[model samples]
Target: MVDALDGRYPRNWAESWDRVGLVLGEFEHAVARVLCVVDCVPETVDQALEVGADLIVAHHPLLLKPVSSIAPDTFKGRIVHRLIRAEVALFTAHTNADVANPGVSDALAARLGLTGLRPLAPAEGAAAGGGRGAGRIGELAEPLTLAELTALAAARLPATAGGVRAAGDPGRVIRTMAVCGGAGDSFLTEAARAGVDAYLCADLRHHPAGEHLANDGPALLDAAHWATERPWLDDVAAWLRAEFPVDVVVSDLDTDPWTVHTASAHKETHP
Candidate 1:
């Protein structure tokens, strides 16, 4: 399993600041059932336990930041302890997975039915060695209005309370599409240069999104960060299942950190 991971995702692809690869547990441990998730949160951990998962393959690392201690006193610390106690291995593929061919962003573009897809911003090292990078730009099968494109994205990607939000003229026609799995504010200029008519991703803040829209950039469609990355879990699981003697399960945890609700009002009985 480790060999497969290393083969498909070379360590050199990882960024200098990233903590990719295995973050917990022994490499040779017997993994019966594995769970694939975007984020290694409490809900995902519970799902792994419920499914009797022996290992978890996640996109985002649980230990991205420095930790002074792991005493189980804090939330992340407690999760680490629980995994160790249960003998569940935790592995993550962050920026490395982002740069791989058919990576998270590519998978997302495929889900949206985009074609002729290519990396939005090809990584520096990747180009020299014939490798792709994070984010993807592609063409839609048929052109649609900005609002229609937003609706299509909401329906295609996993549905959540924060299904989809757009930041362009609803009547504007959309042909080319650019996408990044998670927060993609940095790639706005790249998408514009690629001449994409629409850009879909997650975690688009007020000012940045507003600025891009006002600048006549690509029509933007913001979705739940978790929802956008969740689709790649299946791709990762499929690769692991084909290469190892382990079972892989996709976690259905909504770890977007957003709680959506609508309010209602009562009617008055006055004439």
Candidate 2:
């Protein structure tokens, strides 16, 4: 299973800082079932165990850095203990998966029905490929209002308490758009430089989003991190099924951190 994924998303393509490929489990273990998820959160771990998954091909790496201990007392250590006890293997394909031809942002662009897609921020020294980039920029088939775009995003992405939030005129017409699957606030300038009308991503901070709007850049749409990345699970599952006989499952449980939201209203003492 690891070899199959490595063939598609080569470990060499991953960023220098990224800890990818197999993170746990014995290499000799025969993987008969696989679970895919954006985050290796506890809930998803339980889901993998409950469904009798022999391997987990997660997008995010559980052990990204060297740890001093794995005594089963720490939080991440607990996850390690659980997976090891359950005899489940773990693997990651983070940035490498993002840069693949039909990668994370590509899957997102497909979900939004985008056309004429191109890289929003192409990586340096990357070989000739259609989608070797940090994010994707594309055009909508028909322009829609910012509100409409927000509605479309909410309807398409996995549901979470974070829902969706936009920073621009609600009636602003949006045609060209840019998207990054997770925590894309870093790409705001790149999206603006691409001349998109809107930039859709996850985890937009207040200062950056506000400053971008103040500078008359593209409209911003911030979604839940898990919601934005979840679409790629289907693509991964499809690829896995084509290469291996494992029964693939994509976790539907919402693992986004934010759990609730409340809209503010103007104060008026009437009662």
Candidate 3:
């Protein structure tokens, strides 16, 4: 299983700061059932066990950040302990999966029914492309207004507390667009340079988004980080099922942290 993951999304494709690949369990152990998920939290761990998954292929690394101990007192620690006790191995494919050809952004673009796909920022490497990289650049089959695009994003992406929001004129036409599956404010400038009609992505911060708009960049469609990345789970699961004999299951759990969304009664005008 590790070999399959490594071959598809080579570890070298990940960013230097990232921690990808096997996080726990023996590599030699046989993996019959696999669960593909966006996060490896306790909830998903329970789902993995319920589905009898011998291994979990997660997008976000459970131990991405620094950790002093796995004592089981902490939440992440407890999850680690739970998986280990169940003999379920954990593997992560983060940025490596992002930059692949049919990568995170590829699945996202597909949600919009985008065509003529290519990389927004092409990188040179094994997992990267025949033109794949940071984000995806493509065109809609037909043009839609900014409002229509926002509505499309909301309808297509997994429902989240914070649904799709857009920054641009509602009636503005969007033909070509760029999409990144996760926190993509980092690629704002790249999206601008790509000259797409809109940029659909997640986790756009206040300052950067405002600044990009101020500079007359493309229209923006911001969805929940998890919602944006969740589409990739289905894509990976289908691939795993096709490539291996194992039964692949995708968890449809909404793991986005924001549980409740209350709209403000008073409307504030923004120029």
Candidate 4:
């Protein structure tokens, strides 16, 4: 497990300001039945309990910043306490996973069937070896209409109430594409510089997306943030299962934070 983490997410790839890698528990601890999740929330913890998971390998850190206490009064404290009581270890890859070869962005790109991929913005302080950046730019196998690509994304990613929202000319043929697993609004200019025909990611706000689309920028496909990052969970689980003699379980907690509740009248009308 250590070797896999080191190979994929080198320590140097993590930003100095970020806290990643193993957050809870020791490496030597016997971890059988691991849980893979995007975030280590209470719902995911309950799923881990249901599956009897000993460890949870997540993309985002549960405790990124230092905490003064674990008194169970605070939400984070309660999570920490719960994991400790359950003997469940927690590990996060974060930006380090983003820069890995088959990292978060690569996995997302593959889902989109993109080819000839390269980094949209290469991360700084990457080890001497070749590693891409947080986001990747690539091209589709063949040009697809913007509407078609949007359909493909919706089909590929996990279904959510948010569905898949797109901006730009629906009929515009998109060949070159860029993708980031989560919250890629900051990379708009970088994707623009890469000259991609479209950008697929999550957590794009109204103002930013509107401004970019108004400028005739790359077509945008915004997905649920959790769905975008969930692809990495499989890779993480597989790596842990292969290297360590452990059972890995992908959390099915649907912890996307957006609850879908249709009013009875609305449902009746729609039905």
TM-scores of the candidates in the order shown? 0.93, 0.95, 0.96, 0.91
Query: Compared to the true structure, candidate 1 yields what TM-score?
Result: 0.93
Give, for candidate 4, the lowest lDDT window spanning 10 residues.
262-271
TM-score, predicted candidate 4 vs. hidden true structure = 0.91
- Compose the digit string of candidate 3's lDDT tens values, residues 172-254: 99999999999999999999998998998889999999999999999999999999899999999998999989999999998
lDDT of 2 by residue, 189-245 (tens): 998888899999998999999999999999999999988889999999998899888
Candidate structures ordered by TM-score, highest first: 3, 2, 1, 4
What does candidate 4's lDDT look like per residue over 198-234, in tens digits?
Answer: 9999999999999998887899999999888888887
Locate the minimum summed-lDDT window of 10 residues in model 2. Answer: 122-131
List runs of model 3 lying over 4 Å from the truth. Answer: 125-129, 268-271
Which pairs of residues collide in candidate 3?
none
What pairs collide in candidate 4? 33-247, 34-247
Candidate 4 or 2, higher TM-score: 2
RMSD of 4: 4.0
> Of the candidates numbered 3 and 4, which has the greater lDDT value?
3
lDDT, residue 63, candidate 3: 88
Each prediction's whole-model lDDT (CA): 0.86, 0.89, 0.92, 0.83
On lDDT, the stronger of 1 and 3 is 3
